[model samples]
Structures are given as C-alpha cells and as structure tokens.
Target: MVDLPGFKTFGAASMSDSHLAEVTGVSSNPGQLRGRLYLPPSLQRGAPLVVALHGCTQTAAGYDRGTGWSTLAEREGFALLLPEQARGNNPNGCFNWFTPGDIARCGGEAESIAAMVEAVVAEHSLDRARVFVTGLSAGGAMTAVMLATYPELFAGGAIIGGLPYGRASGVPEALAAMRAPSGNATELAQAVRSASAGYRGSWPSVSVWHGAADHTVAVANMDATTAQWLGVHGLDPAACSTEHGAGWTHRTWRGADGRIAVEERRIAGMGHGVPIDPSGSDRLGVAGPFMLDVALSSTAEIARSWGLVAAAEVRREPAEAPVRRRLVPEVMPANDTAAPPASAATSGVGQVIEDALRAAGLMR
Candidate 1:
C-alpha cells in the first residue's frame, strides 16, 4: 500500500478533505509520462473527464492536494487525470514547454500525455466528448501546447499564468517571452495555426487566468494568451471588455454558429500563483506553495466557466453533501482589452472498460 500523508494548508482545510480521493495507476500507460487517475467513490460509467496538469517543482499529488481537484471531482461526479512530469524531463520537474522536442504533435511529452488521456478514457468508461484540460504556470504553458496540438481531443482548456503557444523553443526564449508585452494579437494567433497546419476543426474554447502582479511570468502574457485565442476565433481586438465578479475583467468571442470560443480573466493585483477563494462556499483547493487565496477561487470559477458543473452537482440537498475539509492569489493589473459578447468556454468523458481490459491483456 502507498503511504498517503495528510498536509495542512491555509484558508479552508480543503486539502485534507481529499483523503477519500483514490489515485489509481493507469491500466496501460503508453505515455512516457506518469499517469494517475482520481476516481470518486460515487463514480459513474460515463462521467466527464478533467485532465489537470501540475506546474514546475510540483508532483501530481502535491498540486492536487493544494488545488483540491480530487475533492472537486468527488463533489462534481467527474473523473480526474493528472499527467505528471518526471524529474528527468526537467531538473525542476517542469513539463518541457520550452523544448521543441517535447511539444510536438506525435511524440515527446505532449503526445505522451495524449496517450495517457486515451488510456484513462478507456479505463473509466468515460465520456470522451466531455474532456477538458487546465494547468498553472509552466503547466499552463503546456496546456496551451495540448490545445494547439490536439484540438480534436479537448473541448476546452484553461490557462493560468501561462504564455502563448509556440512562444519559445528553449528556456532562455521562454524567459524572454514571459517578460515581453502582449504582442500583435493576429500574429500570436497565427503561431497556433502554424503549430498545427492541418487541424482545421472547431477550435477548443479557451479561458485565461493570470495574476496582475505575477513577477515570475509577466502579466502581459495573459493578454497575449487572450489575444491569441481571440484572433483564432476571429474576434475584433478592440471589442468591448467587461468586468465580472471581484474585478475579473472578462471578454468573450463567439463563432457564427453561436458557440463561445474564448474568454479571459484578468484579475487585478493578483501575483504569481493559482488564486483560491477564501469563501468556504466556493473553495475548491487549498492554499500552499504556488497556491494562494486571493478572495476568489480560480478553480471553482474556472470549473464553472468551463461549463462543467451542472445545477445538481452544486445544488444537491445540503443533507446529501459530504462534510469536513479545510483549505485553501493576486489580481492582475487592468488592461483596456474590451469585452466581446459574453460567450464562455464549452464543457465534457466514456469508455468500454472491458474492451480496455482486454486491450491491456488483463482480461481475455
């Protein structure tokens, strides 16, 4: 049996609440990356799947503990897939977001993660159509890689403190890009297109989250991220942007089919880290290390923004909800990016478990 040690965190003790979340090994791990699956006790056959990626120096369990993703999966009836970066991949245990070899479509870290996703989808009998991915910092940069390379696989993606895709080919270039101002929106979007020349399918909806005071990654990168997605969706750069809850400046763009393709959250005064909501009402993760409580819950808000939480998932009778759990960012400076129409990110996962069992040669 693996030793599961409990840890404490600020805000609510939500990290401790994840004791019940069981992390299982993937049945057939094709991805060079290590894969872990978080399954709630009340698991269903065709629940939605969420792929959660960790940042630099973070292990899958550490990030989940602080972020409360496993807890959220339990409450929301979703399955969680965490693709962890091995230390050898990067000295800091960061995904190779800056390495050209790692982000390619068919091989390296990105494709390995995709293989992991496919295996988990089969193992859990998950609804493939409902898949979504989210990440923070370096992981966030990798998240952008996933969306661009595997647009046909994910419905939507959330990037927290991440730079634009294909912005850098190495660590030095990554550092420079992270500090640069948001570049031409059209050019930024074109980078994504160039990354995957043949993928012309419906682009995944994007949600951008960045701290206003993030010194590690310049706040301007958020603008570049927003601009990149906006240009992809063909939205006007000067479209009117608006304010949402707690100084969250937001803008959304929709396609001719009436589907919202992109949305961005520019949090005022937030610094480098994943912002957590101190309010127990909506707290999703704990505050530790790169996780900070800054009056708003990025995890909860992003989940809702991703269109995953149904009314029943959040509004079940109080008597029926599980009890216990204590847990769990600065807002970025304001920019003049105007809000477009109020469209938001679209939301997802099923599998033939027995078929997977046979494929893995675990069953005949």
Candidate 2:
C-alpha cells in the first residue's frame, strides 16, 4: 500500500446522509468492498442508476459532496451507487485497478463491485438498461476496467483523469503507464475486447475528461483513452467534430447511427482534479483538493450527456449551428506531448515515472 497525498479524510458525520444508506446483503462480494446507495426521494421504480467511484484517500460522501453527484441524482431523480475502496484493500484508499486479480471479470474487486451493482438493481427495481458508471483518477481507471470486463452492464461510462484498460498489470507498470501510456488504437482496442471475449453485444458509450496541466497523470493518457474507445466503437479518430469553449476543448465521434459513441474534453490550464462549477446556475459541486474550479461542471455536463439532466435545470446559451470538421492541435504544449504511435518503444522515463508516482502518492 502506498501513502498518497492531496486528499483529506472526512469524518463519519460527513459520510452520513438522509438519502444515502449502506448497501449490504450482496451475496457475491469477492472484492470485499463496501458500498453506499443514494436513492433520491423522487426516484421512481425504474430510475436510472449511476455508480460513482471516488479517487484515492477520499470517502464516498466526500466525493459526492465535491462532485455534487448525489445532488444531481436528487434533481434528476436517478439512483446513485458509490462503491468505496477500503483501507485494507489499499492503504491509500485507491482502488486496485492495476491488480490483475482485482480487474479480471467476475473476480476480485471488479466482481465485488459488479455484485453490488446487481444487488442494487434487483432490490430497487431500477432500469437495467439505463445504468451508468463513472470515476476520478484511480477510480477513473477502474471505470475502464468495469466497462471493459462488463460492457453489457453499463449503458455509458465517463472516465476523468484515468488510463486506458489493461495498460498496466501491477504498481510499477501502473506508475510507468501513468507517466506515459503505451499502445496504438488497434492494440488498445484489442485489450478491451480480449477482456471480455466472445461477446458480440453493443458497446457502451464513453465520455473522457482530462486537465491539460495535470502533472499527476499526463494529458496524453486522455488521447490514449480516446483512441482505445474510438477503436472499440470503430470510429475514425480523425472524423470527429470539435468545439472550443472559454476554458476547454470538446470533441465528439458519432457512430453509424449518428449518436455520439465517444467524446473527449481537454480542459485548459487545469490540473489533476475533477472540474466543477460550484457557483454556476446549477450550483453543482464544491471546490477542494483534486476538485478544481473550472467554471464548467463536469457533473452537470456528464449527466447532460448521459440524458439524466434536463435542459431547464442547466443554464444554456443559444445553440449555434455546428460545423462538422476535424480539428487537431498543431503544437503540443510544453508539459504535454503527443503520445507515441501504436507499438512505439518507450525509454528514458525513469525520472518521469518517479515524479508521477510521487504525485499520485504511490512512492515515498
């Protein structure tokens, strides 16, 4: 277990909420993880369920408070499931995403979380087809693990500051991948498919977010993640539409049916954290360590993309006619460079690996 920094532990009082309660009686919790469920008062019998995973050194409620996931769930009338990482599992309270046993389908922590999801859906009579999952950093990487191992279980998934699936199989490899993720579109896509072989079902839609200035996890991982999902969806990487905003850039790739199968958001000048807008019209999320104030709420935007939030709930500008075109950043910033192409060899990253490991609290 590694001792990481930048996250504060909340007390038991912070973990208590009226609508939030313990998720127990899971008959197949092989990962030995604890869970909390938040059912909004207005939740209907077939409400949507969102499984939100917190980053390292954070509690479920603390993450819920910072990201406003429960608050959004209340307003949108959706069910919220927060799978917590126990200290016993990882001393840093980070999910064991790189552990082979934990990430394998129907085993270890992945299976434990899957069992919790199944129990919640069954007991609450929720809509199975509308279930979604999302997470931050380590939780975000685990999100990829779940989406890869159990694609049939999720309608959509959002990864914030996370790595691609199967990029690492242990802590040292995980840290090295954090410093620089390796693989091209085809290789990365094969990793996801191989995770769940012999399944020819529809893939879940994906949303990815990363800070341009995130030193903890390089922004290049965002591109690697996007490439992996785009490969899974079989969409051309150069065929997406781009939208630029005050503090971020957004890209979208549509499937043959004209629906967005994979989308990416690159936030300018932001660091390693979940971007939030606490004082926005929606008043979503609180700013804290690893929860940044970027004037754009990832909570609201992600829910909106998921079709869980209504237009009236979010303040909007008049819609502009979008021009379909491919836009690429011509020059990489000083801190972030283009990731190596498919199967590219990597070297001279010892210091970078060390720095990233320290940033993630994975190294002393």
Instruction: Highest TM-score: give the candidate number.
Output: 2
lDDT (tens digit, per residue) of candidate 2 on 220-275: 89999999999999999999998777667889999998989999988777777788
The lDDT leader among the candidates is 2
TM-score of each: 0.77, 0.87
Error of 2 at 128 (Å): 0.6
Q: Give, for candidate 1, the lowest lDDT window spanning 10 residues.
A: 1-10
What global local distance difference test value does model 2 have?
A: 0.82
lDDT of 1: 0.69
Q: After superposing candidate 1 on the true structure, give the runs of residues whose Cα lies further than 4 Å from its correct spot.
A: 1-31, 181-183, 311-364
* Residue 25, candidate 2: alpha-carbon lDDT: 76
Write down the worst ten-residue block by lDDT for model 2.
323-332
Q: Write model 1 residue lDDT over 129-242, tens digit each, in one string.
A: 889999988889999999988888888999998878988876446656767844588788888887775888888889988876676678888888988988887887666445
